[model samples]
Target: MWKPILLILLMIFIGVVGFHIIEGWPFLDCLYMTIITIFTVGFKEVKNLSPQGRIFTIFIILGGVGTAIFTLTKLGEILYEGGINRFLRRRKMEKKLKSLKNHYIICGHGRMGKTVRERLEEEKLPFVVVDNNEKKLLELKQTYRCLYIEGDAAQEEVLNKAGIKKAKGLAALLSSDADNLYLVLTVKLINPSLFVLSKAMDEEAERKILQVGANKVVSPYKLSGLKIAQGLIRPTLVDFMDLIIRRKELSLYMEEFTVKRDSDIVNRNLSECDIRRTTNVIVVAMKKPGEDIVFNPSPDIKVETGDTLLVLGDKEAIDHFEKSYLGGIS
Candidate 1:
């Protein structure tokens, strides 16, 4: 913006001085003549020009032409790169939110929500975030590829825009317990089956959240205290667990996969399946369909439909099980 203005000012200053020296014209007349010449208005020159004035005119043309070309090129680049298209895309996402279904609506994108989003990303879960802060939303969009609806999470219109009716779950991590409780109640009223995980600031709020139909209520402060104590008492174990949870290279995660009727592992015993040998994953527990959980089950225990197998493994091993053992081929 300033570049074009500066270029024009420089041209006009040069033209005024040159014209005064060559034709003895006033500053105003020289300025007008310079404008007309640069704009190619074809106006008559105020007076005849000397050799110096002609050279000055050449310089003006050279500078003005380059400036004009640069300005036009920048404008073209902005349009070509879809600057306006991206704005329209965001508007479209907002419009499309009204009809979204089977989506997860996340209220608040703070620390807890960030962790939840990370886990969701690992599982490739689709979700939309709602927050009042535009700056925070911008930062989140830049860091994590996800849809966002900017508004107060407690409001019905905001929740509706987030497609709460179609949403399978609502994770309310609002800073306040009262807000989370209100959000939980609203979500439950809108969709009775919608699974809700709310944040509670205290025990009283935790109880209220449960009463309001929140599937789970987590208190960050309480959890942090426990974690700190655990770190002090069992530092080595905590460090190892943290490494598994936080390190992308290790990519270790605990996952529970349910066996479907058609799953290849439905009728296979642990020994016969040889998952440990094949996938290098540890079978931590086998949760039977209608029986107690078998922690560290023996090799002879048979896998069955509707049973969940809790395993600890790297992402690659989990991917293999999800593909080869589950229905997914890749």
Candidate 2:
């Protein structure tokens, strides 16, 4: 594009200089004559041309017209190719977005949003990212090959494009608390049942965000401060948590499973399930509906339908336990 444009400009300068030197016309008249001749506007000459001037004008016409045509052709080709490619990519993206169901929607592509995306991806959860910044979205797509929508996350249209209606949950991690607040409100209005998690910079923002509709609010600074304090007080405990939660080199994993109403474990006690012996998974805690979580639940406690169990074990053990006892993946 630049090469062709520069060639056209060079041709014009040659024409202008040639007319000024050959015909002794003023700079302005020479410019007018050059533009008219090059463009084939068929306008009358600024003044009668000398033999030498007419010869110069002919050469100028040939070079200028040829360059202009070349430039136009290149411009047209670029526009056509770019337009078609964009159309096809958007069509493919829309098709994929529509096909998604029970997926998570992540708003913003900043630090918090990126962290959320990575964690979800690590867990093998299906999700789509939304961001108003095209550059950031493109970078993410290139790096992770993940699905994303380029638009303001706070807007209903953008959320709808991200399949907000069918999404199981959404995370609002926009740069500003105000943006996240608006996003949560918009999301709740569209799908009140959809769970929303948002980030806030301060307690005030967290309060407002919760009031708006966010199911949970997190503050990075507050969490960081607490982690630092905990590290100072109980470094060993933090290291243990990091080992399992980060899953760097350890095989241990923590996962939650819901007790289906029809499962065999539903009316039985923990010990009766023989989960540890059978699948090598430890029942860490249990949370019954409308009740606080019970840590290290007693083996004698009876399991009931709709109870959620937080278990800790290796991936294979958890998968086996979930499949053999809990039916299958939820």
Candidate 3:
């Protein structure tokens, strides 16, 4: 791909230097003559050439013209093989993102945001990324069949293109806390029910995010410190949870499901709901809207409308449970 281009450049340089030396022409005139001779554009020379310059023109035409043709052909092949296909593929991907529903919108492709995207993809979750960096998005496409949009995430048009109104959640992991906060505010203003988790650079940003209706705010540095402490204090528990979290490699996984207002099992106690008997899935905890999560929810705890159930079980069991009873996870 590159060799032909380099050779063409070398040929042009030789032609310019030759004309300047043999014909005593200025650099600009020499360059113009070289271009015309190489492309066979049928333009007369800027000045009459010396006998030596005429001889030099013959060699320049031989080397430069052939090399130029080869370079053009190679470029044409490259465009046909890769560039055109990539453009068509991007158009197809945009259509998919525009039609997505109950999906996630990830804003940013920096380190933290990329990590979040990888985990979501590993779990087979549907999501489309929004970032202003087309190069980074291109790199991501080379590795994964991920959908993305190139635009400023803070803009309403970009968010709408990502289908933010129908999105289940938004992960605002922009490079700066201020940008993430602004994104969270914009998203929530447009879709108040959409869950938003954002990254914060400082305590003030964290407070502002929630003030703007972000459902959760994360400080990656703080989480790293807490994780290091937990690793030392409770290694066994962390390792066990890690196994359950590896959805692609492990059959057992942990997920949350919502109880609809009209579910038949609503207002019934956990014992009577008999989730374990029917689906073989364990309910690890349950949280009502605006309430604290009840860890290891007691058997007497009633399954109520608007309760979120965090369960751990095999894939088949969880699917069966979702199909039979759970409304959908928010």
1 or 3, greater by lDDT = 3
Clashing pairs in 3: none
Candidate 3 displacement at residue 309 in angstroms: 0.3
* lDDT score, candidate 2: 0.89
- What CA RMSD would you report for each candidate? 4.3, 5.9, 5.6
> lDDT tens digits, residues 4-123, model 1?
567666766777777777768888988887777776677887777787777877777777666656766766766755576677777777777766777788898887777787777776
Model 2 spans with C-alpha error above 4 angstroms:
1-81, 141-144
Candidate 1 regions exceeding 4 Å error are: 1-3, 6-10, 13-32, 40-47, 71-86, 91-103, 118-124, 141-145, 165-168, 258-281, 286-294, 297-308, 323-326
The order by descending lDDT is 2, 3, 1
Query: Can you give the TM-score per candidate against the true fold?
Result: 0.75, 0.74, 0.77
| Candidate 3: regions farther than 4 A off | 5-73, 81-83, 141-144, 327-330
**Cα lDDT tens digits for candidate 2, 135-218:** 778776555467898889988888998999999999999989999999999999999999899999989999999998898999
lDDT against the true structure, per candidate, is 0.80, 0.89, 0.87
Candidate number achieving the greatest lDDT relative to the actual structure: 2
Cα error of candidate 1 at position 170, Å: 3.2
Give the higher-TM-score candidate: 2 or 3.
3
